[model samples]
Structure formats: C-alpha cells, structure tokens
Target: MWHLYQFPLCPFSRKVRLALGEKGVSFEMLREHPWEARDEFFAFNPAGRTPVLHHGPKGITLIDSQAICEYFEETVDKSPLILGTAANRAEIRRLVALFDENFFADVTLPLLHERMKKRLVLRAPPDSKLLRQAMRLAHEHLDYIDWLVDNRRWLAGAQLSLADLTAAAQISVVDYLGGVDWSGHEGSHGWYRVIKSRPSFRPLLSEKMEGIAPPSQYADVNA
Candidate 1:
C-alpha cells in the first residue's frame, strides 16, 4: 500500500489526495504535524512537507505534489487522467503549474498564512498588508477562473484531467477560509458545486478546520 504523509489542512497535500482519488489509487494516511518534526517522519523527508508518498521501494520517498502526481500517472493505470499528446500534456501541466505558482503565490498562501493559520492555531492575526494583498490577488485569480469555467467545462478544457483536480484543490483551500465569494460567480460556484459532489471530492468537502465551523455549503457537495 502507498503511504502518504499529510495533514488535513495543507492544500499541497490536498492536491495529491485529489489526484490519488482521480487515479483510483489506495493509500494509507500517515498523518503528521510536520511543524513538530518527529525524527521518524523527519527521517523520511528532510524538508518536512506534507504529501510525501512512500511507494514501491520501502525507503523511497516521493516529494513535491506535482512530481508525485505525475510519477504516479506515468507509472500507474486508471485510464490516463492525462495524455500522451505533447500539446495536451503541456496544457495540463501549464494549468497545474499556474495554479500552484501564480494562484498560490499571489493569492492563496498569503491568506492561509495571514488569516486561516492564526485562526486555526489561536495565534495573533497576521499583517493587514498580507490580507490586503491576498484579497486583491485572490479576487484576480477567481476572475480568471470564472472566465475559464465560462469558456471550458474544466480548467484547461474538458475530459477531467489533473487541471481540474489542481484547480479544485486550490479552490477548496480558499473555501475553507471563507475566502471564496461564491455568490460572485454563479457559474464557477455551480461548477465547484458539481466538482464537490464527486465521490473523490466528497472527502475534500468534508474536511474542516479544528474549532472552526466551515460555511454551510462546505459539506453540502451538491451546494
């Protein structure tokens, strides 16, 4: 069985989880509070990040969400969530990379570090500058998504590839923080509602921060 080192809250970890579900791979969760850095888990990943997968060889550790997801896609079965075509593969990778780099760098991380982290861990709120920047970047990112959903059934196009999972995972994190103004875009919200309703996405929607009540629609995958 594949062993996954993950926390319930990390979006990076969550992406891998979604990918695993899309690929129909079964994995055992080895939950970790990576900040504490136990020697056992630390030994597996020197970087101390979540979504580290142990597969095949006992000691081989899979690091980075994209790398792990692509490796599995290449090596495993399940109808090729991606493609053998260069153009198609590049498009999927481009969206995946964009969501990780552009969206997370400009939007998601700032909000997560500034707002959600403090709320979840009972720490003082982060800088207002961070929140302002995150809010601006977040809205910009969502507008781009609204256009994509308006133009295509999924991010990057149809056929339910890693592109969709990548965007969904990113959006899920924002939803958890109530950072998403779902009512702003009926189409994106409706698309998300459908994605959330999927069996794989059901587990993601159910995730809640400790001591924090998510919005009513959080678990209402159909909503």
Candidate 2:
C-alpha cells in the first residue's frame, strides 16, 4: 500500500493522484493543509506542501510532485504514464514545467488564493483585482493549449503522458472555481473533455469541499 499526503484542491497533489490512478496504484489519501504548517506534516515535507508519497513496503518517502510521478514511472512496471524515446520524454517534461511553473504562477495560484484557499482555509476575503488578473492570464494559457492540440494528439505528443496530466490537473482546479471560460476554445475543451472522462479523473471530479461547492459543470465532461 501507498500513502499520499495531499490537500483536497492542490494542483500538484492532484497531478500525483492522477498518475497513481493511471498506474492502478491504490493508495490512502491523507488530507493535509500545508497552509496550516502542522509540525507532523512538516516532518513529512520540509517544504510544507501536500503530496508526499510514502511506499509502505519499501519504507520510502517521496516529496515533490514531479519527483514522485517520475519515481512511479520507474518503479511501477504495470502501467507506463511517461512514454516514448528520450527526446519525446524531454518534451513531456517541458510541458510539465510550462504548466507547473509558468501557467501555475500566472493563473492557478491567484485563482486558488482568491477562490478556494481564502474562503475555505484562510477564512478571508478574496482579492478581486488579483482574481481578475489571473482570469485574463488563464485565457492566454488556454489559447496556447488550443494551439498545441491543433497539431498533436496530446499536449506533449501522440500518446497520453504526464504533460496532459499536469495541464489537466491545473485546469481542473481552475474549472472548480468557475474560472475556465471553455467557450470558443473548442480544441482545448475537447481535449479536456476526453481527459475528464477518464476513470482516473472520476475520483477527482467527485471530490467536494465544504463551503465552496464547485459549479455544476465542473465535473461534467460534456461541459
């Protein structure tokens, strides 16, 4: 068995969850609010972030979402999420950085801070200005995705890979806050529709948080 310490709405945590589910790796999810910075949780991850994967049999603890996902790809031979030749895999890693770093800092973090964390955990008012800026930035990222899918079957390449999982994880969190304006971006929307319908993604859609219900269409693949 494996144990995953994660926040309910963290994109990084969700990425690891999708990778684990895609590989058919069953694990116990222990919810941790990194914002709270609990002493015990800090012991698990000095960064005070969610998503620390613990392998019971090996007695190994994995920190950082990207590192954990790569470890899963290497250790779990049953299913392969990161595929293709070395060069192809490099492209996958590139897009993962695109979403995890650039897209996340510009769009996901602001919306998450305003829409989810502030209301649910911080119990503070949202910064409308920051939220608006984040929304504007999100459209740019969506357009970029639309352009990418115009040529490739998947975000990184022909096959499903960590690139798609990473992008979807962030976008899904934004969708939960009703931040994604799916209209006019048919290519991006269609890609997300397929990803959302996957069995691995079903559990994520089913999740609900108190005091901050997701929009009705948040879980709907058709939407």
Candidate 3:
C-alpha cells in the first residue's frame, strides 16, 4: 500500500491525490506540515516537502507532485492522464506547468502565505493589501482560464487530463482562502463547477485545514 504524506491545503498534494483518485489508486493519508521540518519527513524527501508517496514493502519513495503523477501515469494503465497525440500531450504538460508554476506563484502561494501560514504558523493577521493584490492576480488568471474554456473542451484538449487536475487543485486552494472572484469569468466558473462535481474532487472538497474555514460555496458543486 502507498502512504501519501500531505497537509490539507497543499495544492501540489491535492494534485497528486486527484491524479491517484482518477487513476483508481488507493492510498492512506499521512498529514504532514512541511513547515514543521520533521527529521523523519526530511528522510523521505531531502527537500522536506509534503505529498511524498511511500511504499513500505517496495521501498519506493516518490517526491514532487509532477514526478509522482508521472510515475503513476507510466505504471498504471487504467486512466491515461497524459494521453492523446504528442501535440496534445505537450499541451497538457504546458498547461500543467502553467498552473503548477505561474498560477501558483501569482495567486495560490500568496494566499497560502497570507491566509494559511499567517493564521496557523505566525499567528498574525492576514495582510489586507497583499490579500487584495492576490485577488487581483487571481482575476487575471481566471480570465485566462475563461479564454481557455471558451476555446477548448478541457484546458489541454478534448479529453480530461492532468492539466485540469493541476488547475483545479490550485484554484480550490485559492477558493478556500476566499481569493476567487468568479463574477466576470462565467466560462471559468462553469468549467470549475464541472471539475468540482467530479468524484475525484469530492474528497478534497470535504477536507479542511485546522483554523481555517472555506466559504460555503467552496464545497457546493452546484454553486
């Protein structure tokens, strides 16, 4: 059996969980906070990150969300997340990188630092100025998502892929922190609604972080 070490609000961890869920892989969860800097956790990943996948009997440990997702994609044949033509696969990878890097940096990371880490670790009030800035950036990102949804069936192409999982994971975290403003982005909002309704996304919606409460609409698939 595989044990996934992750905290509730970790977007990368959520991405891995979504991929595993869609691929029909069963694993146990081990809540881990990277900020705690536990020695045992560091042993599993020298970088000391969450979402480390460990197989005790097989002695296999996977670190990094992209690497772990790819590991499963290659090994498991049930659901192919990076499927389609080479161009389509490339598009999937590109969008995955966009969400995992650009969107996270512009929106999710700021929200995590201001909303989550501040409240939990620093015990300080969130910065309103920074929060506003993050929300503005979020709108920008959502605009791009709106454009993509308008153009394609999914973020990458026709079929559901890792790109959708990656974007949804990041967006879910932002929405949890109350950073998303879906007013002008109907296309993105509709797309997100569909993603949120997926069975693979249900577990994430039900989970919560200590000292934090998601907006009521965060868990409502119909909203």
Candidate 4:
C-alpha cells in the first residue's frame, strides 16, 4: 500500500491526490505539515515537504508532486494525464508549471501565508494589505485562466490533462482561503465548476482544515 503525507490545504499534495484518484490508485492519507518540521517526516523527504508518497513494501519514496504524478503516469495504464503528441505533452507540462509555480507564487502562496499560516501556525491576525494584494493578483491569474478556457476546451488542449488538475488544485486552495473572486471570470468559473463536480475532486471538497472554515460554496459543485 502507498501512504501519502499531506495536509488538507497543500495544493501540491492535492494535485498528487487528484492524479492518483484519476488513475484509480488507492492510498492511505497521512497528514504532515512541513512547517511543523517533524523529524520522522524528514526521514521520508529530507526537504520536509508534504505529499511524500511512500510505498513501504516496495521501499519506494517519491518526493515532489510532478515527480509523483509522472511516476503514476508511466506506471499506470489507466487515464493518461500527460497525453498526446510531443508538442501536445509539452504544452501540458508548460501549463502545469505555469500553475504550479507562477500561479502558486502569485496568488496561492500569498493567501496561504497571510491567511492559513498566520492563523494556524503563527496565531497572528492576517494582514488586510496582504490579503487584498493576493486577491488582486488572483483576479489577474483568473483572467489568464479565462483566456485559456475561452481558447482551449481544457487548459492545455481538448482533453483533460495534468495542466487542468494542477491549476484547479492551486485554485481550490485559494478558494478555500476565500481569496478567489469569480466575478468577471465567467469562463474560468464555469470551467472550475465542471472540474469540481468530478469524482476525483469529491474527496478534496469534503476535507477541511481545522480552525479555518471554507466558504459555503467551497464544497458545492455548482458553485
């Protein structure tokens, strides 16, 4: 059996979970907060990151979301996420990196730091300035998503791929933190609703972070 170490709000972990779910791979969840810096967790991943996939019987440990997803993509014959021609697969990877790195840095990370980390780890009040900044950046990111949705059936192309999963995972975290503003981004909003309704997404919707209540619409597939 595989054990996945992750917290509810970790977008990278969420991405891995979605990929695993789509590939029909079942694993046990083991919550780990990297910020807590647990020594035992480090034994799995020296970087002390969440979403470490460990298969005890196989003695295989995977660190990094992209690495884990690719491992499954190669191993599992079901639901190929990084699919299509060389160029098509490149495009998928490009968009995945865009969301995983750029979107996370621009919108998701700010919200997590100002809202989640502060409230849970620091026990400090969130800064309105930072929150507003993150929300503003979120709108900009959403606008780009809107453009992508308008042009392509999926974020990368006509078929569902890792790009969509990666982007949605990051956006889900932002939405959970109440930093997303769906207004004026109807294209992206509609696209998100469809992803939210997928079977792979249900577990993520039902899970919650303690002491941080998500908005009512967070769990609602229609919203």
* TM-score to true structure, per model: 0.90, 0.97, 0.98, 0.98
Which 10-residue span in candidate 1 carries the lowest summed lDDT? 113-122
lDDT of each: 0.79, 0.91, 0.94, 0.94
lDDT head-to-head 2 vs 3, winner: 3
**RMSD to truth, every model:** 2.1, 1.1, 0.7, 0.7
lDDT of 1: 0.79
Clashes of 3: 0
**Ten-residue segment with the worst summed lDDT in candidate 3?**
42-51
Which parts of model 2 are misplaced by more than 4 Å? none
Candidate 4 error regions (>4 Å): none
Model 4's alpha-carbon lDDT is: 0.94
Question: How many backbone clashes are present in model 2?
Answer: 0
* Local lDDT at 32 for model 2: 81
Per-residue alpha-carbon lDDT of model 3 for 88-179, expressed as tens digits?
Answer: 89999999999999999989999999999998999999889988888998999999999999999999889899999999999999999988
- Residue-level lDDT tens digits of model 4 in 1-223: 9999999999999999999999999999998999999888887688888889999999999999999999999999999999999999999999999999998998899899989999999988988988888799889989999999999999999999999999999999999999888989999999999999999999999999999999999999998
